[model samples]
Target chain A: MEDTAVLSEIESGQERIDLIRKDFPILDQSVRGHTLAYLDNAATTQKPRVVIEAIKRYYEKDNSNVHRGIHELSNRATAAYENARVRAASFINAGSSKEIIFTRGTTEGINLVASSWGRKNLKSGDVILLSEMEHHSNMVPWQLLAEATGADICYIPVTGREGLLDLSGLDDLLSERVRILSLIHISNSLGTINPVTEICRKAKEKGIVTLVDAAQTVGHQPLDVQEIQCDFLAFSGHKMCGPTGIGVLYGREQLLEAMPPYQGGGEMISNVEYHQSRWNEIPHKFEAGTPNMAGAVGLYTAMDYLDKLGRDWIDEADRELADYAVNRLKELPELEILGPPTGRAGIVSFLIKNVHAHDIVTLTDRCGIALRGGHHCNQPLMRKLGVESTARASFSFYNTTQEIDRLVEALKEIQKFFNQ
Target chain B: MFDDIDDLYQQVILDHNKSPRNFRVIEDADYVAKGHNPLCGDEVEVYLKMDGDRIEDLSFQGSGCAISKASASLMTTLVKGKSVEEAKQLFAEFREMATTGNIPDGGLGKLEALAGVYQFPARVKCAVLAWHAMAERLNGSEESISTES
Candidate 1:
């Protein structure tokens, strides 16, 4: 969480982290009679007391179906919900609040673009360029679109060790037929940060609409949708320590205005007739029936929290943690790390020989350390990497070095158990 | 947390996981089925060489967590000499043992090591993936088995 009031707290570093850890009461508990070492931040982050309390306050005091009720509670809910939209837009440094449309989460946000913009523009044989490292949320919707429209799909292959996108063949791929380029800002599994500006700039020049799936990066780093210059951006609040069922889709004003409505429902329409209805303006047009009001309250607080803590601080901490994790994990001859150590983010994916990812995860659970073990919803990437699955330990700023050590110790124990 | 790691990854289980028994294609196999545990990305191809009602030979090949590989390995050894009817009964008992934590009585000797998996419900699928595939193969089902989460 970033905050100006937490200047001293941000500058304090480790001592600050010690205090910060206390904010999340869930961290204090034990999972299996051992202290919980939550390393699954990419999957979902634990909520701090302040964020939780905000949701509780909203439900208790300001709970109402947003946007239609004329009562005081409705006004409060609408205010909170609209304020959240403003906060979400500002969080990404979007051009305007109207650019920010609330959806269930990143998946829904992406589906909105694929179904609405994709359906309207993409024709049979037109190409949608994607990166090899995109999450299924970003890929599958387009796949379904391709099935419906017969729009061809191509990928920017992952280059060398760090799993960076191979832009060498990008020119060949970005021909006249390429209509849209939807790519991941930071790979959820590999932790490689893609060059969004360069990629988006290229696609923009080609008149291809650009969408960035910022699900993994928005929470951990400073985001500027204007700087990225993508037509659309999608991310989940839950990934950023906010509640689930709340997410943001930042589309360019003109693009959102031009695109058809994603879902037909009450709030999305300006006026409903028996058979025909006029759609509402940009952001509201995208948001369907009763939005997650409590989620908006909690998400606003979460963004406030992250801003207070500072993005630079979180990024530095995660980089250090990932480097430490990669370096420490690399010491074992039996283990092989997935991405390069140099500039990768907080996530570290690795494999121990002859050990199934599930085995490691299951065994680690007993030790009270949560590590993800699977394809990580990047099944195609997994297949490309020549492994079925990998064990991933993704860190958040609230996580400490001591926790990483705990994960390391637990992993060693797992190895010894299997090795012996 | 529920049980000792040793209880789940027993010496016998570890041994099978390390050197899975009959981990190869049974040439001219009467039945073949593929199993996938999508959650763990475990894939097992179970092959059977049946002689009339008897399982003349049984084998499997797969890569997975120790639990999955070990389960498939142990299954091959146990089912190799049993008749098709006996194998079916054994599988029923295996499923019963996996679903309920009660190590079912009578005749499921080495297979009982998988009892530790019951405590961790997620791993129960891992333990049963191969069995599900083999059951499908034996029953001549058209669909490939998938243990999805």
Candidate 2:
């Protein structure tokens, strides 16, 4: 994962997208009678053929448990699995491959830090700072930590509807008592790309530990953990072009070395006795039981595939799709779009005047379009925005402007149908 | 496939959703119970004013999608002026029709509009959400009902 490809793919965006679409075999299908315009990328991405093939190849050839046996199959599996760790570390620009810990996904990664590191450092009267737009995965773990450690939780306020953080009182919120600050790098529901670099800098000056939830951003953009200067970062592989049940948690080496083991099992132990057992090193100490060997192989292929396509190009193309969608949707009557007015990520959440989001989603699905409609695990933010749920259309780089046009056309038909 | 969606949101269902019948609260109701659909956050309150063994009046208030709002509106109209036992029977019949696609003999007249919802399995709960609340209240249970349960 070196910076060798310098946006060479962006020379002809549409031509390249047509070629890229061919790499994903699932895209060549129809829903109902029309071509499937999948707008649910925010939920989970469709895997490319390379990633799918990599998993199949691993199972067909090198199927064995990692780091236990002296057999040839175990050696092959161990090499592939450890290579994935090195790739994940390089993907985030971590200081060492030892800092990369494999977990189930973002949820388990955040829970690992909250249960292991949080219980050790936090005490009564300490504060855990979160934002109003955090997904439940990022918020609930800390809540459990607070309950266990007697620590209080506070939130950074979001400006209503526009979805930007109101940082006027950030200094007051990051007071001496605050032990950690956890926030999402890209909002799942609002599509707001938060100022994580600036926020992490401020937290550093105050000696507050920072953890960035990169579930939404890591797959769509280039993430450098050293550049962000955060102590920990969490992301899911499924949201990218990888298999599920495999993800990475990047922790600074010093902090991970000090934290206790998250779980105890066969692989995560060094020495075992009836009374006591010694723990493994940094990354292995947190991983318990047999890990998802096939999933790690798939994720390794996905990281390589994404880098070949260039994340910078993907980010630009995603923004272009979102801008096109927002503009075309605004043409419809009585439609209100949520999130920042400009420079939003690929997600577009909107609501019609007299239509519930569920109805809107159902109608769109009839037209062979896939959209997500719900609180999106951001119930607190939805309550603040005064909406029960919203209809969201999230884009991937493979999505075209023509799909946005189709979405706009479908929404128009829905408005007319309801109005009649 | 589009025809199935059209059947689900037919003109009758859309009209009921637009101007719901008896869409209000009875200040002095005999029984009132709330219905909730946790999946989509839709909620409805069913209020009954009983006249001994007969339902003297019935009304509802809520916010939900077209299927839910229209289902609540039609349920209130169908149960009004009917005996408690008859209303309970209708509730059971409606549930059967929505869930299993079995229209019993002497079919549900207006309530049959929601019969198409069985094709969309995710929305079966939406069509039956209000009926669950009304059935609970008529059965002398004051607890709120959730379709999830």
Candidate 3:
């Protein structure tokens, strides 16, 4: 009972909630003259005032090209940029700041690994194992790599009956020839939090490197690279309340040291001559040219906002909201929730039986309720679930139980309209 | 806000969607085409039964949003027994009505209710998916069949 009380306190940290919400001024606004629900958090979250101000501050005061100039602004810019790297390292519990390389977003991060590590390690007969629930960002890159490197791509099927990654199939698929096991930490479409630790452990036993695409999981849950023991993890800052065009690629220091640099540019090189040049070490080697300085500052501020909120508090809130939404939505006869009803991370994908997803979205929008409708960038998973499209409502900590009630009410109206 | 969606999803449109006129496979179809909106995965297959200048029968099949379904239903009702030249003229009028947000002076016939759809920019494709497919079929461009949004 004491443990339960402590859990409740951790879940409902009032001070933290007020502090975090205060920083995000956009939360107070209304849409179409109604209070904005902002349920499309998985696509890209709204930035807080702190993150917005950080971008403004960088442009106003610390604006300069990093790593090249000898002037004061340049030095400040470089320090601010590297400071973000340190923050990113601590955010994911990476060994060193050198392991955190900034890229455009998760898409670029996966591509970097596919081109650099994949090009070197994968051979003609080798296999690359990926989950059936992978986003197109994860799937397409491997497919392109496999085509170029003569490697075979294998999938761990979901089957939809269990709505979990097929661990039994993982045992059968993992072998000496399987070079890398790339999977999403949490499904963007289905919201299934995969058992990455177990998958990583099994892959390690088979002497394979693992890459966890935590695009949807990182900010929603506490993640430690050391605890998971995955070789690499990637996530986009934009999805976690930061600005676009800045994301983190967390790689093991040793592994990052070995892989070839992705792009050739000014800051990434050690020394340049007329003929050839040597590349810089780890993070810098991969981060080519002028980085997204404003974007990095925004991410830093966003991380600071999350940290102040206390990660556990946000996680619990999101989980409770998701549970409430699932339970309420299930009450509608026409609404069919996809994937495992429970164990889902703050997302619900469902189809209104007779109503087309696009129509549902359109009608919902008319009611000032925004949601994502389509394949959610996982066409293969859509096929697996025997659905062409679905309406997805992904929540964040800012989402409230009242919002879930609104969603449920909206869904019932949709069903009734279609039935009539 | 939604006391009843039947106002937007009119009874006539629902009736047309349920039992769409000209919904069948044309056996001796001169031109056949399919249109798709990749963004929404809405598809429509149009089969035209042409007897020289006059359209003997026109039919369509596929799946899509209510707008597309209703538009296809309306299209069949408009062109079922019309001449090829008359059908082309209707297509032009329909296109103008959808794109320009201005209904022609003489009422839109059965298609008047759909004028509200132009207010929704994203749904214009849903209204035009079948019409575009019909145009592709009329042009005898079977290979050029495509979905538009």
- Each candidate's root-mean-square deviation in Å? 1.9, 2.4, 3.8
- The deviation in Å at residue B40 for candidate 1 is 1.8
- Cα DockQ of the candidate 2 complex: 0.58
What's the lDDT for residue B13 in model 3? 70
- The lowest-lDDT stretch of 10 consecutive residues in candidate 2 chain A is A1-10
Instruction: Summing lDDT over every window of 10 consecutive residues in candidate 1 chain A, give the lowest-scoring window.
Output: A1-10
Query: Whose TM-score is greatest here?
Result: 1
TM-score of chain B of 2: 0.95
Candidate 2, A32-90: lDDT as tens digits? 77899999999999998888888988999998999978999999999999999999999
Q: What residue pairs are clashing in model 3?
A: B36-B147
| CAPRI-style docking class of model 1 based on DockQ | medium
Query: Could you list the iRMS of every candidate?
Result: 2.7, 2.3, 1.5
Question: What docking class should model 2 receive?
Answer: medium
TM-score for the A-chain in each candidate structure:
0.97, 0.97, 0.95
lDDT of 1 by residue, A194-232 (tens): 899999999999899999998889779999988889999
Which sections of candidate 3 miss by over 4 Å?
A: A1-20, B3-8, B26-31, B83-86, B143-149
Q: What is the DockQ of each candidate?
A: 0.64, 0.58, 0.58
Winner of 2 and 3 under lDDT: 2
Candidate 3 lDDT tens digits, B1-149:
56545435677776676677777888888777788777666568888887778888888888777778889989988898898778878888898887766788886788866776777788788888888878766766665445542
CA displacement after TM-score superposition, residue A291 of candidate 1 (Å): 0.6
**Candidate 3 C-alpha error for residue A306, in Å:** 0.8
Model 2 lDDT vs. the true structure?
0.91
